[model samples]
Target: MSGIACAVGLLSSKCILSAQPQSAGRILLQYTAVRYRRKPRWLGTAKSKLFRVPERHQQVEEEVAELKRLHNVYHTQMKAVRRFLIDEVEASKLVSRAGMVIQTPEEEASEWEQIQRINEEWNRKIGEVREKRLADEREQRKNYILERLVAKEQRDQENRERVEERVRLEKELARNYITRDNIDKAIEMALVQPMSYNFSIDLSGNIRRLGEEQNQESSN
Candidate 1:
């Protein structure tokens, strides 16, 4: 095609109409009118010697329809791109928020380690208490057993001493009774002797001796 001509021959090719919507529309309309020639019906008539068919206005409905289809397609594509961009932004925000809320593996591991440490410390303390308690109980039992042994020894000694004392007392009583019976027999022999025999009594034993009587007879 030839370079598109303006409806007005005076219009310059350097003119640019991108300032406002109204100006851009006017320029586009003028450009369309010139590029697609609108022919009048009375250009060739029968009076002319060389008769020719007059030009008719070409229907540009198909071009307008094609432009509309392209416009709609481009608009839908741009809308899809904008929606995708918006969704991506929202997803990024949500990901950032989730990062703020959720704990990382390292942090969770550290927390679990702290809990284990506390539990281990408590277990150690409890073990110490239990061990100490058992030691005390063992000591108490040992002391009790020693005390019982000592008490038993003391009781056994006391019982033996009492038995010995009872035996000694019985022997002392028997000796005293035998001594009294001998003194009585000596006194009876002394009293049975005649007075002419000159016998003197030894009062210490309540009895008289034969030597005293013989000595008195020899003196007489």
Candidate 2:
């Protein structure tokens, strides 16, 4: 009877040891599941921050470029205005010298008529100069606007490219991070993040929509 009880106790202890391994494995699996659940949220936050940094950098670059372009335009306009003023002053001096050459009243009248004709011709020329300058200004404005638009488009495209690059890197990084058991789900989640906007029409539309939404919310 004593021998039988010892064997029974030994068998029961072996069964308990076997059961403990399964329990420990179950606990480990639960911990792994919890870690898996937490990883995506943390990874998403990290990637969001990464994307924001480039966007901010892009905005600053665009603003600086715009400021420099406007400064160049300002200097060009100032130079044009200065040249026009100098031409006017020179023409006035020529008119004064011609007036001094006239002597008798008749000659003076004839000279004055010639001066008048000259003045009229000069005035017409000045008017033409002014118009040309104005046209040049209009052309510069058109060109500036076009340049800004083109630059804006390029910046937007760069942003899109950066985003794509970031996304690709994020995937590569995720691949490096994931274990064999979790790779499929990680890949799927990575692919599911929405593509961002990076075009003129989309940017304009987004701004307009934001304004409208804000206005509507404010009215409420």
Candidate 3:
């Protein structure tokens, strides 16, 4: 018991040996009173007066600085945490709102109307293309017919020129036929001329062989 009391440091060995349970409790109570007796709080004048030792003043300053540092660190961590939570909640709400959005009937109808307008524009463009194609076809056909007519007129002119040229050659042959001596000579001349020249020669030259008739009259 004495060793225990000495180890506790609150009581002497003699008091511990002499004490009963009531006396021990009284002693503990007295010790507690002494330990808890109200004193001036160590701040302001009280701090200057009570904490006279350099060690005590240094301990108090270190404790205060440590507490301030911990408080600043805690506040900074709490601010970051709060901002992160707020941002996360806002993002979640935005995503949820997006997922929940539904198009109004009026908006849907407007979209359909816009689509129909686009389709109508497409049809109009197609119609314009078809009309242009038809007009182009008509213009091309007209040009083709005009070209054919011009070609036919040119061919007709060439044919008429050929007929005129043949008639001129036949007149030249007729002048030669009168000078020809005999039927064999006329036939030989016809072989060298065009067919039109041959047709221009007739029985008039045969019925009146120029020299044969003159000879027959001379004989009569």
Candidate 4:
């Protein structure tokens, strides 16, 4: 058979074998192409290829020498062209720089005056802002100090009132305190009362005089 006929027949058979059958309305798809994977390096050479020798292509010495000479000439020509282009670019830049206008002394002085004016204006504006900021900071500091003073005054007032109230209470209680002037009266009252402290406490936390109950029974 012809090559084209054989190839078409083989492709048809491969497609038929690889075709996937579809349901009701879906189109059928077939894969007829073959893919090859590279052998892993760790696997080494195959057993069947161990004795195989690959043929090497040989070149004529004269042809190889001619090719080497042509390569050298090409590299040298390229280097020369690159160097000429770089020199031409550098020369063009120098010519451009040289063609720039040179300023007159008067023009230079005018430019310097303009730059100074701009610098002076910037300094003036910066100074104004700095002075305003400093003023605001001073005002804030003054307010803070005023507030601290007010708070300190309030605290001092509160402390003074507390001390005065405590002193008034102590003075009121001092009226009843024992002193040398009242010692004789206090002793006379103690002797008239003849108070006794011989007592016992019961489980109910009541204090009972030891002889008071007996004295009461005898009087009855």
- Most lDDT-accurate candidate: 4
Model 4 residue runs over 4 Å out of place are 1-60, 193-220
* Model 1 poorest ten-residue lDDT run: 1-10
Candidate 3 local lDDT, residue 119? 100
> Candidate 4's error at 97, in angstroms?
1.2
Per-residue C-alpha lDDT of model 3 across residues 1-220, encoded as one tens digit per residue: 2343324444322232233356535632222212223332332234335556655445688889999999999999999999999999999999999998598999999999999999999999999999999999999999999999999999999999999999999998887564546778777777998243222334566554456567979999
Which has the better TM-score: candidate 2, or candidate 4? 4
Q: Candidate 2: where are CA atoms >4 Å away?
A: 1-110, 175-220
Q: What is the lDDT ranking, best to worst? A: 4, 1, 2, 3
Stretch of 10 with least lDDT, candidate 3: 28-37
TM-score of model 4 vs. true structure: 0.59
Report how far residue 218 has shifted in candidate 4, in Å: 12
lDDT of 2 by residue, 1-220 (tens): 2454444444444221122235545632222111121232322344335556553434688889999999999999999999999999999999999888548899879989999999999999999999999999999999999999999999999999999999999998886687989989878987997444432345446533455567879999
RMSD of model 4, in Å? 12.1
lDDT of each model, Cα atoms only?
Answer: 0.73, 0.72, 0.72, 0.84
RMSD of 1: 42.9
Clashes of 4: 0
On residues 1-220, what C-alpha lDDT tens digit does candidate 4 reach at each position?
Answer: 3455445545545233355667886766665654224443544666667889999989999999999999999999999999999999999999999999999999999999999999999999999999999999999999999999999999999999999999999999999888999989889988999788899898999888979778979999
lDDT string for model 1 (82-107, tens) is 99999999999999988885779999
